[model samples]
Target: MPITRRSAMTLPSLLAAPALAQPTRPIRMLMGFPPGGPTDFVGRLTANGLQDQIGQTIVFENRPGANSVLAAEAVARAAADGHTLLFASNSLAMNASAYARLPYDPTTSFAPIAMVATSPNVLWCGTSQPWHSLDQLVAAAKAQPGTLGYASTGNGGNGHFGGETLRQALGIDISHIPYRGTAPALLDVIAGRVPLMMQTMVGAIGPYRENQLRPLVVFGPNRAPELPDVPTLKELGHEVPDSGVWFGVLAPAGTPPPFVMRVSHALQAMLEKPESRAQLASQASVPAYLGPDDFAARIRTDVTNWADVARRAGIRPE
Candidate 1:
């Protein structure tokens, strides 16, 4: 059966697993992005905060490759011990359609632990662009249907989906320009080589402040607190679901539920801290905690939604 929004995962089944001894050594969490990016920074910060609640050292290992597929595969093949976990992002779901095949089944290969935080994507353009707002840019694209292109960190990413969502909404044709990573894609947008792009609030903050980019609209359900001046797509009645980037935890499919619960509780506890909330603010994110059951449901929804986007956009890996 296909993994629908209803059947993607079940927390109760994982909870039925036999409880196992917790690891005495440090826990190792793996992420797929290179160091010095927003994902790495958010992952490390959350890990540090959660470390206190768990009373165990959590070591991070970067396995940067194929938009985190390399590290995700590593965790899926690791022992089902709770000590080895995957700190994945929204790409976990997007990769389902982004790539033709992945070593691990995103829906079945991992136990959804917790969804920690999420931030909106800021639709931005270069300072040199003539349009000052999303409507204006949409008009420009309408005038020259296939000429406008939007840059994104990679194919089958939030940018790809978000950009495609806008295209579908307006009935326009805009090309997707995929770069190896955010840095290069963003650099091109700044140089006006690409007229537009969607970046997470965390990654867009610095450049937006320096006036290297102009944020026209936020693609989240609500306006980002960090960019209150920029209106959200919802505010304009675009009727699209939130396509923001999310950070979450995952474990091997058979990992003991009690251990997963422990980490999930620790993460929920971290959100209660003012310092943790403030720290997340610096990352241009806000805590949106969801325990195992809810997190599984969220993954189900995103998997279903992004897959639709991939189908509509005809996304295929190179």
Candidate 2:
């Protein structure tokens, strides 16, 4: 059974696998928001699920600033090997309309992987504030006009635009007060520095439970189980806008289609797992899974619609 060097070389070649079957490198997932935020909560859940499903190491990096534009730009410029991913949200869609120019194009700079989860925004006010319901808040704003002010995480953010959408829908005059992030905004609200704010349900859930913030209404299609007594904007006799925070995965544009499809399928399978769904639900994130094409379409639609909203609201670039 003596084998020559030529025979040994042939055996090794026979056992070798194709390039596509080889293991992929570790992935880096970038988040636009700082830690301890809703997006972070959802991002970690997704990253873990994807790591398990893909059998690859996934590192989550938080590059918080300018409402995720910085992180978006970083991901857009990364190698399109399906290794670098951006944990994008509706904020990116808003940025498309809010900013005159971005380092990266939202629609064309990245390939959509899959839509992960979504959570409705809640209309909340300081517990000590006068208004307890949406009607009362609107009436008070009508009486005070420019005197009423609201706070948001930042300029041209979901909370800012959500408040603007409500104002336009109801014809109210309220000034906006933009904060560096949600923490300061919530602090000001609880301290009565501002009267109202429209924030994500997940972010508001803690303050609501602690009785520091009052939930006036949920801005989604259905009532949030966490705040069941609160009615939706539609139920309160106002046409609700199609606006809410959504989390999705995206890789740099020009990534191979096969690689994109592989990530998409892995994400779909991960979200379908019961444990994954439960983890997301516990964070106030509703499971909303969309494939690559549909996810891309949703982002496009959001950017276009938010552009219209920002235009009507006279929200110019910052």
For residue 121, model 1's alpha carbon misses the true position, in angstroms, by 1.2
lDDT (C-alpha, whole model) for all candidates: 0.84, 0.83
State in Å the error of residue 214, model 2.
Answer: 1.1
Point out where model 1 deviates above 4 Å. 1-21
lDDT of 2 by residue, 1-318 (tens): 123365445433422334442237878999988898899999999999988866679999999888899999999999887679999998888898888889988889999988988888888899899888888988898988899888888888888888888989889999889888889899999999888888988777778778999988888688876787989988877775666788999999998776666667667767778898888878777878887899999889888888888989999987
**Candidate 2's error at 115, in angstroms?**
0.7
Give each model a TM-score. 0.91, 0.90
Model 2 lDDT-worst window of ten: 14-23
Shift of residue 163 alpha carbon in model 1, Å = 0.6
Candidate 1 displacement at residue 15 in angstroms: 17
Clashes of each: 0, 0
lDDT of 1 by residue, 52-94 (tens): 7666789999999998999999999999987799999988988
